[model samples]
Target: MEENAISGDDNTHWFHSNGIITSIDNSQKKICVDISQKNSFFDGTNITLNCNKSSLDITYLEAGQEITFYFFENNVLDTEVAIEKLNIVTP
Candidate 1:
């Protein structure tokens, strides 16, 4: 899949978020994502997603799993500020 960058909002300090995978560091409880917009800079590149103290839980999440996340501007605390929800589908 293609990757891209997401611009954050200036007002609420939030930006656009998308679905990605928790590529590496599964043991450390971290989710890596490619927030870059499709066909934008850093496309097809891997971006480290941070998961801070939020209600969203990604413990059961595994590599290659798809997830929707929320983006915020001037917010670098957690790569994944807010996780939309989990999609469980049979493969």
Candidate 2:
């Protein structure tokens, strides 16, 4: 099963969000994503999503890089959530 598939325990579900890399904190291993699209997870415009710890190689990530990230529902706080799966979206 895909990690991003809609499956989870009774507590929460998973969702994917698309956005651009606004900033990166290599020391913290965190990537600040500027959400460009809206879904059930993000409803506001221009929200920055702090994503971290993905199976993908995030070492090569940089600002302006488009990406799709999977995260759990209700795990977001002010638009920030830990990334379960991160995939670079090539143009």
RMSD in angstroms, all models? 5.6, 4.0
lDDT of 1 by residue, 3-70 (tens): 22344335353343444574756455467875434433233446556554355466767766655454
The best candidate in terms of lDDT? 2
Give me candidate 1's TM-score against the actual structure: 0.52
Worst 10 residues of 2 by lDDT: 1-10
Clashing residue pairs in all predictions, respectively, total 9, 0
lDDT score of residue 47 within candidate 1:
56
TM per candidate: 0.52, 0.71
**True-structure RMSD for candidate 2:** 4.0
